[model samples]
Target: MNYPEFLSYDIALAACAALAVLITLLLLKAFALRHLQRLADSGRLHILRYAEQVVSSTRLPFFTGVALLAGVSQIKLSPMQDRWINYAWVVILVSQIALWGSRIISVAIGNAVARQRTADPATATHLLLAGLAGRILLWSTAALVMLDNLGFNITTLMASLGIGGIAVALAVQNILGDVFSSVSIALDKPFVIGDFIIVDNYMGTVEHVGLKTTRLRSLSGEQIVFSNAELLKCRIRNYRRMQERRVVFEFGIAYETPQQEVERLPQTLMEIVSADYLQTRFDRAHFKGYGESGLMFEVVYHVLDADYNVYMDIQQEINLALLTVLRERNVSFAYPRRMVHVTHLAEPQESAGQAGKLAA
Candidate 1:
């Protein structure tokens, strides 16, 4: 190729080559991105979505840097200048790779969350935190790689960071503890959003599970918030996980009732409970013990449903049935009462004699 006197053939050729490579890379990237988007939108292949995300994340600066690096490699330059240029190239490549890695992580996490969002909201929430941590780790590694290429002591720097990290950890130990507890909650799944949970003295429906705190909507229309760390330390009763509810109830009839009827009470109870066998399973009904006012009968059963309302409805029907049966059988529910009798007696023989003497 012919060139002007001021410009050498090699320099001109290098310049032309750099320009061509830059244009080619840009055109190829655009074409691939457009194709990948179409494939990703079709949802036929999940890998295409990830590829699209990575390709789209490639910034123009990276393309320019790569082209400049390619063109400069063909030119004559001082050793120090070449070394710096190589360092710049490493930075550009590592940064873009880190960006692509971050996008991939987000895409993966987002897809996973979407899949589980309807069935397992708590898991979806945890996946977001996991993605953030993954991206942070990816970028940190990329930075370290760039530093290593640029002739920095990464091992020493890591050691220093380790020591400093300990102090920082100690300073923010409370926050870190809650974060760890949030991770534990996600993994262990003690309770999830929409679960009716009882923690210590507080009972509520789980409204939100956050990194530091978990919030609940109480039955009485109050919001209760608990630190995740503290929540983990306490016992959690997740009613949503319960399959059936066990019920124990005690009632008393008048002690004056016939012994024959008392003996038949257990059988009567069994019949009453077994009538709703589809909803309840009768365990036992027995004359438990004597109460101050009546003979106490204890009944144990399990409601086949976990819903509180269903249990209450079944209980109410059983109670009304008991009332009707007792009334028909001429038996009465017990009430606290006392009986007193007054006896008229001669005041006293001595007092009577004294009164007689005084009258005489």
Candidate 2:
């Protein structure tokens, strides 16, 4: 067997060619990314974002393998060498495909989530979970494909995995429940981030939504975390949705005030409430009825703004104006009082003399 002294020079030449090709591919990738980034920066082809993502995740292994094939034509190889090269490339091709496919799923889901983020931030969390699930599925399926291409029977493997997956799910059932509850919370819009809510007895602004729990920033400046399932179960009072605040206040006037003045009390209250014309709407001002010590007047108004500070400001102004006007009208604020009659009491001096006689 004249073993052909196949010179090592041919192998060296092939190695050099493969190295050159890999370097060229890398430079091309860098240049392509830079160009794509420019296109993205131009702010015109918004579609370039997805393209950039593809190029970004894009690996050169596939091209590297292809470049290695170029050297194959240059060499006189044994059947064993050729077969080994073929198998190696086949594995590379599968990996590259899986890489690209997974990236595409991620990019698409990211874009979808971004669009939904602007339209509705609540949906973004749920969409993020969906994106994660999709990526997992894609990569797992890709792994199966890779194994199958390597001459393994995936039918039995998939069947076995199905049972294993079920067992794993059961083991983490509580965690999974919370995860799904977060999705449900996002979809249902129970309360979005930044909303001030009172759930059961806990009151706070929602800060973040997580797979297991939702976090809140309480008025006391502490962060409160609630399990998504428990949060959903609790009754939520969303004060963030309030448009206006209805306020009712009552005051008393001296019973000695004239009947005419008492009749005029309702008009005075209307004037007082309307003093801050822009912030409040006078609902009703009534001389409600006689009280134990005085005449009671009830005033009802609606603050036009949802801000607590604004409500307080308007109420304070009304109170100041009412006090001034009531004084001008000689209307005195009433206080509780009682009168006791000394109809049958002995004089103090006579009582003292009687005490002295008893002592003697």
Clashes of each: 0, 0
List model 1 lDDT by residue over 181-258, tens digit each. 988888888887788999999999987777889999999999999999999999899999899999999999999999
- Pairs in clash, predicted candidate 1: none
Give the top-scoring candidate (lDDT): 1
The reply for model 1, stretches above 4 Å from the true place, is 1-111, 117-129, 138-157, 340-360
Q: Each model's C-alpha lDDT?
A: 0.89, 0.82
lDDT of 2 by residue, 232-308 (tens): 88899988778999999999999899999988889978887877465898899998889988999899999988888
lDDT for model 2 = 0.82
Judged by TM-score, which candidate is best?
Answer: 2
Q: lDDT at 97 for candidate 2?
A: 71
